[model samples]
Target: MKNYFYFLFFFLIPFGCDNTKGNKLVEKSTNDSSSIYLDKAQKKNIKQSEKLKYYKKSFSILKNQTNDSITRSKLFELTKELYKNNFSEDFLESANLLTTLSTKAKDSFYLAQIHRSKGNYYKNLPNYDSSFIHYTEAEKILKKIKNNDGLSLVLINRSLIQFDTGDYTGADKALNSAYLISKKNNEIASLYAISVMMGLTSMETKDFDKAIKYFNNGLEIIKNNNNLLGEFNKETCLNNIGLSYQKKEDYKKSIDFFKTALKNKSIKSEDPELYSLLIDNLGYSYLKTGNLDEALKLFLESLKIREELKYYNLIVLSKVHLSEYYRQIKDTSNAKKEITEALFIAKKKKTHRDYIAALKQASIIDVQNASTYSKEYIRLSDSIRNVEILSQEKFARIQLETDEIIKEKDILEDKNRSLLYTFIGVVFLLSMLFVVRAQRARTKELMFKQAQQRANEEIYNLLMAQQDVIDQSREIEKKKIARDLHDGILSRMFGARLNLDSINHLDDPESVKKRLEYLNELKEIEQDIREISHDLSREKQDLINNFVSITTNLFEEQTATHSAKLTYFMDSSIKWDLVKNNIKINVFRILQEGLQNINKYAKANTITVNFRKENNELHISIEDDGIGFDVSKKSKGIGMQNMISRAIDCNGKLDINSSKENGTKITLNIPLE
Candidate 1:
């Protein structure tokens, strides 16, 4: 019943450290003394202080030498190495010196690199806004210079900023752009970085299979270029692959991958953090497989290491796993203890995802308080989803602003060329504009007709609703009449016949007496039949009479309650039976609404409603003599709209004519067919 927090795999985005190599700054000049210092600074088996000394010596030598390509290249290489090694003070000093030299040499390429390196610096400081600004500036320069490799690397850096801000979709878009550029330019290091990033992005979106595929792609790339990824990088890929499989619930495969990652003996000492993660994941897989003993052992080992390192988030994760393990073993007390501690740490860290996880585990183990925990979990989960959506929108806005900045620069550069084509472009646009306007007018007409049709269908449903009620009442009346005829009239006639027969069997005197009584009974039955026949005829007439009665009542109400005088005419030649029920319903509704409108708005002294049959078409006209307003100018009210819709529903057309101080006339014509 309890859910546990899954271990989050850590994937490091490699920002192409290999790209720093093969600097053109001083590579051509082997005779320069600075080259020797540069080579020594790149050696792996060196102390930070020693590397700093060599870089400083190269900078000093190159400063005194002539500012030729060799001198400038050597100085740039020294500055880049300092930046890479985290010699902040020395790196700043050397970069400032190189900035002056490169500007004097008019080197746009090196200048752009400085900006990119600064962006990385700010990104590590977690100042995403500043980092984004620097990346944008570098991108502009690279685009201008048409250096695809530099542009690709800058795009990757921008994507990392986006990723850190919880804008996974934006990050994916940036990564895709970078991937395309890097692949086209055959930039291996950039390609590897993009693949790893894309995989991590996929994992964030819960596409575990896609993530595994991308991770495998990274491994394949590493296989071909051993120098592209170190042993630790390879270990990351394996761990991530394991995590993806775990998410997919393929526990056995996850265990295999996690074990393979843990096989690196030096991981425990070299990267204790990654080692803890691997073991915890392996333990969780064991828990899922019901291997309680091994699961508990690995869980405790991972928890102890995380505690030593004081990683709050990791500690919470381990406790959650332990809670799940305890719950599996039916050890409720221990499960409660572990989950409570995990929940406390998660809340203190304000780690929303982990907090939600802890809450879910709490709900399952602590049955008495499960409802409260579950409510909080749902609330936090919804809040985090909304926040992530907003974060994505914010990052998208930042990218848009950056694009606008570049677009402005391009506009300035293309100003003259654009001017040359403006006249011809304007002529073409004018022609297209006329065509578009005509098409849009036609589209609007079609849309209006469609809307009217929908309204007609809706009115038809309303009419059917009324018809259903009437038909139900008529059916009930018919049933009552049938029962009376069968039970009362037919039964009495049958009894009278039997009586007459029984009399005939007796003496002539008794038979005459019974025959006289039978005649009297027959007379009474004949009266019942006559009354029933008349009732049936009346019921049949009510069908057509229903419409007339309703219209008459409407007109009477207006005359009795209002100041206006109402007059209505119905043509005797019009056969009510020939008209469809739907048409009758629509005409009755329209006449009713039109009279009400006259009473309310058309302060007319006389109102007339005329119904006539002409050439197989039914025409209804309502005229009001009140101070009539302009028909073309007045907006159609809801009542008028309904009237028009009903008219259209019956295959009819409505027309209205009115003028100031003149009577208003509305006419509806519907085909009888």
Candidate 2:
């Protein structure tokens, strides 16, 4: 398990560039002259102004001829590249356009591509579940079209995500699928990336020799190519070989390869961070070879670069190295300080790799704290390994489910073929077919009735629960009123009555003054009773609108249940007499359902529930800071369906506007005379 944990930590280190590659995306077509991943976009060369200029040109051209396949395709391809290259402002526009175009065209190929784009987009957002959904949709479409290229791309994309999530087995299977496509197509560029990933997975299983073979194949594919990716690939190959050698305890060859990777111009210009990491890795190699001075110098240089860049995780790595160097040199104080800082960062950031490294190092230098550090290292190792296992199992489940779906589809196709062959025999069986159809219709009707019954029962339960809450609130209000009247108003009234009687027994000016004071007190008591009565009326009865009261109660409950902060307000000036009970009830139900949905899924930090009257229409809006889906693309779940039903029942319009990063907003409008 401990070995497995280390494998995960080293998982992507050999890949080189990592997410920084996203930043370097240059606009390129499929035939782009680059050897990196196919058509790697060059972001550093394209200024923001240039991107915006081209985007405006493309937008204007595409907007005028949206229905034109040529223009739409060009616009989509351009925007897709632009978005991937980190030109994010146009992403939503691209998504909206592609989705609209795909729907209008009703082309499975275009729709599949759209879903594929969505999966890629969500993967970048670190939304694995959404990515999985999009990928599944794309896979289904690809199967329908039998598009090997599309399937291979989906596998490659999903494999990268799976690897990041610690699903090594799943990642390997996906890479293997892509490997077959590469073999059949002779896709050198695709093969290069797939081989690297396969090699990384092999490393996880401790297959050093197999990992080397894959890395070497990748190297051969791009070693002589003049493209930017080719240059980057060469650097990747060298680094991975070096890391493999180091892992295998072959420090001399590892140090040699590390030095060669550092000299690559791509590493120097495009990724200084990668350069620093190589330096750090080389320092480890030097340390293993007993080159203390070289190791210390390289470690400090790496630390200095990381500090300048403020690369947090890399900074933790550099600090760990520095701590080890200090420990070697018998600088106990500095060793303690460096490792302590590294440990602090690891804990604060929840970086298991750094945490493990720091714990292991501390156990060596700080004997008194060694046992504590060792225990923590063991615990975190177990935890990381357990998560890896879960990820693997979940990925396997996804594969199994996907395979089952495909098998079902194949069976259905076979059954349809049999029906086609038996058509003439079946022609004389029309009467029997009708009878079967009628029986199916009856069964469908019966099922529909049962479903309807269940829905009604659920609605009734909801209403009952709501009523129970209201009743409890009423009971609590009654107790509060009783306490206030008895403890406050009654006591004051009793004191005033006693004073009134005493006042009649005196005739002096002071006695008269006391009588007047008693009368004032009596008047005040009467005012208090009136105030209490009004309070009871407000609490017990909905003054302005029951819709507002109910929504407020539900929002308060949601806020209490979740971590999200809530702000709510209802217009107090609206006349309740003008609003019908049916509309009020429907609106209340809609608001309740909407808020419940938000609480369950929204992972939001803040929410707003607003109620107002505008142009003789009651407008109720619920908004959240949670991750929201595209309302147009997202399926309407039963909760949303129920809300829509209630809105229709009230003769109101329900509008939902939502997106991933911006969140969801639901607006309901009901007419009031």
On a 0 to 100 scale, what is the lDDT of residue 575 in model 1? 73
Which residue pairs clash within candidate 2?
Answer: 25-41, 25-42, 26-41, 26-42, 36-229
Q: Measure candidate 2: CA RMSD.
A: 22.9
Cα-based lDDT at residue 23, candidate 1: 41
| lDDT tens readout by residue for model 1, 1-673 | 0112222232333223324234433346656678888888888899888888888888788878886666666666677778778888887787777778777987767767777877777787766666776787777776777766577878888887777667887889889988889888877767777877788778778898899998899778878986755557677788888988988899999999999988889999988888888898899999998888999999999999989999888888899899998899899999999998998897677566777888899999989768767876886677566655655674565556776644464553365256436633653564376368647866787678768856875776676568658867886887688678867877778777776766676667976886877877777786777677567646754565555666688788888999887788999778775577778778877887788778777889988889898999998899988888887889996678878988899989999888989979999999997
Q: How close is candidate 1 to the true structure, as a TM-score?
A: 0.50
Candidate 1 stretches with Cα past 4 Å from truth are 1-75, 89-106, 232-234, 263-266, 347-353, 367-387, 403-673
Report the lDDT of model 1 for residue 532. 76
Q: Model 2: per-residue lDDT, tens digit, 63-95?
A: 666474454455566656656556665765776
